[model samples]
Target chain A: MTQPDKGPVRPRHNVKIVRKNNRMEIPSSLDYLPKVDQFVESKLKKLRIKKDQLVDIAISVSEIVTNAVMHGNKNDLGKKVKINVEASPSQVEVIVEDEGTGFDPSSVECRLDPESLLKEAGRGILIVDSLMDKVEILCGPGKGTKVKIVKLLR
Target chain B: MKLSSRDVGDVMVLEPKGKIMGGPDATVLHDKLHEFIDQDKKKVVIDLAKVDWMNSTGLGILISGLTTLRNNGGELKLANVTDKIQSLLTITKLITVFEAHDSVDDAVASFSK
Candidate 1:
């Protein structure tokens, strides 16, 4: 029987190209934010996402990744942050998973009152939600905190 | 972030460039605002045309600047806010707190009245 021909080298994520539905891991570093930006930009550039849309998506991704690195990983550096992207014709989905113990989202305060306007900080997640189409966090159990964000393509 | 300032009439215009992440970047903006406050220079405008983006730490600095200026019997305002930064402000509900203008000229002109 003739052996099936092997194809040319195919680019893969991480050290190994795990098939779709498989997961990849990344170091939780602030510097890694730029790398994430490059990866997302390269993946989405061909789709003709508008410049404004790209920026919105990119910024939202950065905010969530930063949270994963700082809050979830606690800047441990030794711990890892995992990001998975799944792109479909109609929408793009991204999952950011951090190993740190998760906290209640409801507890994250938003001082939106007129008196609290001059105060700084506590707005990263709020901005991410406003920019992204949908954001859902799944935490608890052996699975770490997973922040899934989606953006429409069309 | 690199911050440079100049006097626009009686008001001071602060120009900050690059990202305003936490750490040293936060200190510079805060210290400068305090320096101005000590000098009793109350009217101020932060020209944000060049800032790429800032996190919560950066937002804190702006808040400190505004509050410090106001306590000193002066005022602080923002000018030329980019979409990225503006979105952050809106999300934080800081949009309600700050008095922002479309341009530095408008910010400067507002101080006259």
Candidate 2:
């Protein structure tokens, strides 16, 4: 059987990305969001995930990664965000970790509230939770944040 | 994301193709909307037909545009919202916030009504 197409091979920028199989590490900056999406999606595509499920997983990854870059790592270029993917025939799991002090996840405001509906930020985690089949947020002060999201392929 | 805009009568229709996940890509869409806002272009429609998907960042941008436009006595609408984006809007309850139409023409015409 021919190997699956991995999409385009774009030229790497100045951002140092360490890629090994289904794992990738990058600097903590929003500039790498697209790159992160590309890396994760290319891997998921190989699994023959349905279009809708693929988009759902892609969106969730984007949300978690954005949080890892902005809130988790404080967008400090010195810090780094790591993304690892594990896929089986029926599901895919993505883990995004950042090197920074973590905050209380319960403190996250509910964007669904009428008062918070207009807020610009703060919806990343909410969206991820809505899309993913399983979401595990491991965080603590000075321990960094690790968001693992799992999506079932149907 | 690649962004382009055009004017239909008094309404500005902005077309953004590709994912609108956060970062500089999101900034481009945010800036373009504000540019029109600063120009006093009150009516706007974002065509989302080409967008494969977007996360919270995209939603934030839409909310920002909607609130800023309304605050300035303008209005922002959505045209051709894809199924994925529609699901997002529904999940986030933003579906109730903005007026979305089936097509760009419908959105532009609604601005007059």
Candidate 3:
């Protein structure tokens, strides 16, 4: 017997996302970065932010979350990365916390140094700082890291 | 992000769509660039016209490709960088590190010059 046509065959994605209260939690893995981006972008889009400002916010959030996952949590699958977003007409704030021993924020290398120009990494925090209006990094040895960034809508 | 590549003369043009924020998707572009390098097709042009926006991870990937190619006696250039990415390059001071062109044709033509 011939099977009924289901139109064009479409690929299926087995994606499981966890979110609550304008926040999201994911295992410390870069594989979940897109989910974080999607969650944050959805929240910001509702505020009707300008396209450029929205992009800036999204980029800043991605940078913070990446650091949380890669550096703060050391990509430990057992650890968790939490992202909380709060927004208003004038500004948006994002907080990403990781469950791992943190490092000195001042230790972050400056990518603008001539010697570091071609380095493949160490640019995320700088990019985040440049894109957001205010950035607060709270972390220390044996303490988990929490990065809070605020961007003023233009 | 989605990546597609085609050859324009001796130059390889890579078109990556969507956001290049990190994750498994970002690795696709990184691996593709290195794969091209392994195949000895090193003169590369990344067409950023279709990319909506990318975080520092994307920029790192570009730098990785550029440095790898340069070290191997090849080179990488960028074509059609969007406003958002242009701003990013400027803020990060990477604007001086890359060769950007108005179009893929121009970028391709540049490899000959």
Candidate 4:
């Protein structure tokens, strides 16, 4: 959407979009979020994925990346978030890795629970898991959580 | 994200165009929701027809608005729920919490009843 009405692409920080070794890496800061989303969307478009599927994958990417930026890298800005995408004609796989202390993904409370429903957080994982066909949280041993997500293209 | 609002009788319809992923955009929506509360507007409808998609942060903004409005005896409703968002709500079990409508007109009409 290069429409002038959409305004200039935000460059509010030293956010960088790198295309190296078939992967993308961004600083672990919220400032880089918009750029990351844009890069991911463009890559998805190149893969010829349709609209509805694109939205789902985009939302999932944002959720995990935000967690990596905030919870994983703790917004250090010095650390970096690495995103790798491998797509075939039938499905897509995305791996987002963060440089921060990892935690148990299972420990997160269900947002669907009545007691937790109104809480304004903790729903990112839920959304990702629901939208993607498969998700694996690879973390521990001081290695940051690497979220691997797979979704089938319809 | 961009947020705009207009009055439909006593009800207010808010149109947020673009992605509500988080950061400054999320703050805009949160601040505007509180602004409506400060204005004493009891009924609010967030038209999502233009919203491409939103992450958990977006969902959080909606929940924050809904709970805050309810606390103040006001109410928040959603209209033009996109398929991706609808799926998020359904999976989060929020479909049971928020009152969602198919259109802005219908959402505003519900406030009257």
Candidate 5:
């Protein structure tokens, strides 16, 4: 975040924050993605994580947020996406929840497949799993999909 | 994200500055690619030099452009691929698909040959 870090002079209301447990919520649409990126990056910057690693985490979270808005909620303006960030001295964790019909993570086709390689979609989970140290997906029909990812700071 | 395009000879060079996360921003680039395709501007190069980073959604946009151009009997290439994005293409094996160059000039030159 050395260069990408936002100065404190930026606007405060870009994203809503709750002191309760470090969480944020936005409508289930793609419009708020930049806010989510800034919100997550600012938190990671405070942790003093490496710049490259910070970018990896930021990109992964962005991908998940997109999936939530598009597939989970079907871009329904009425739905919402919740993001939770938790950090320790050694690692950081991000949790994303979307109000949409749940999907089976395993059911997703392999993006590495030759046929799907040039295909324009279906690489979100792959990218997230490759970048984050650990990724866990929990979902059931009508229950919504919760994706939790962890990255080691050390 | 902001996108600007110009013609370098017959090739269209699109320079997008900022993150390409999926959303309205992504849509604009996607739409612009097809817009050029409709106009029969086939030879293309996407200069990623100024882009800070992009997630899979960004990668998807590139594929969309690549495929669309191919279907139209045209071609698309990438230039100044950033390190973070290069790793992504490698990991996803898309490195085998898109033709990427070290510089925009080289990418444009390849279009003529």
Candidate 6:
């Protein structure tokens, strides 16, 4: 929403429909992570988010989106991933939703300790949490995972 | 990710360009790092100034290199860490783990110390 008075809060489902405004729809593919960063960075710049802050938010969003595609959706082309961004006066919220079984964040062992440092996986979620102001993960037996990441605007 | 390696004196400097995302890119760095280890070249310096950015996957690669070298009685160090990557290390508390230098020459010099 270009209007300053009327906020830009909208739901985007289809990939085609996301092209309407500030929203971007990404496929359930990890290969698209960089593209997602490019889109988010440009939009954040338009919102006057600083370069450092932009990188932090973009990196956080990428981690969440990558997890949704690789872990939740399992990179299934049949499944879909929707990313919606809503910037209010106070903060900016980006939601990454996937049509797959959800994961428990607590179950993940980040292994930041000395022994686990050499390992490859498990740092995605931890880094996201540290970078974002707020990270909310919602999932159920039948319901897919929805990750809401919010960054305070400065 | 693209990798370029050259020998500076006895040390090996591997310059990886582009984002070190997961998938084939991860394997490339892993294999190259190990390749040097296999050759008994334990002293290594990874120049990160040219790199655009790296996710956890990139950090993992660095960890893998560090440990592998330590096991071989060699060591791995980082040079020219960009602001973006430095922040990632700081947030993850990895800034405490890796020794970073302002330039490649500095990192290479640290190996002697």
Docking quality band of candidate 3, CAPRI definitions: acceptable
The whole-model lDDT of each prediction reads 0.76, 0.86, 0.86, 0.85, 0.85, 0.78
Query: Which digits, one per residue and each the tens of the lDDT, describe model 5 over residues A35-91?
Result: 888888877777778889988889999989998989999977777899998977799
lDDT of 5 by residue, B56-100 (tens): 888999999999999989989999999999999988999999999
Return the top candidate by DockQ.
4
lDDT by residue (tens digit), candidate 4, B5-106: 888888888888999998778877888799889989879999999998899999999999999999999999999999888988888888999999999999
Q: Residue A28, candidate 2: how far off, in angstroms?
A: 0.7
* Residues B12-107 of candidate 2: C-alpha lDDT, one tens digit per residue: 888888888877778888888999899999899999999888888989999999999999999999999998889888888888898999999999
Model 2 lDDT, full chain set: 0.86
Residue pairs in steric clash, candidate 3?
Answer: none
DockQ head-to-head 3 vs 5, winner: 3
Candidate 4: regions farther than 4 A off: A1-11, A15-17
Displacement of the residue A21 alpha carbon in candidate 3, Å: 1.7
lDDT of 4 by residue, A1-154 (tens): 1112332236466656677754889887766667777777766777778787888888898999999999999988788999988877899889999999898876876645688788989888878887889999999968989999998987
State which candidate, 2 or 4, has the greater lDDT.
2
> Which residue pairs clash within candidate 2?
none
Model 6 lDDT per residue over A1-154, tens place = 1112221112233433244366777667665666666676666666767666666777778778878888888987678778877876567899988998776766877766777655756788888888889989998866789999998976
CAPRI-style class, candidate 4: acceptable
Candidates' DockQ values?
A: 0.17, 0.40, 0.41, 0.46, 0.37, 0.21
Clashes of each: 0, 0, 0, 0, 0, 0
Better of 2 and 3 by DockQ: 3
True contacts kept of each: 0.38, 0.58, 0.59, 0.55, 0.54, 0.32
**Which stretches of candidate 5 lie above 4 Å from their native place?**
A1-21
- Superposition error at A67 for model 3 (Å): 0.3
Ranking by DockQ: 4, 3, 2, 5, 6, 1
Clashing pairs in 5: none
Residue A68's C-alpha lDDT in candidate 2? 87
lDDT of 6 by residue, B22-91 (tens): 6556667888899999999999999998887788878888988898899989999999999889988887
TM-score of chain B of 2: 0.98
My TM-score estimates for the predictions, one after another, are 0.74, 0.93, 0.92, 0.91, 0.90, 0.81
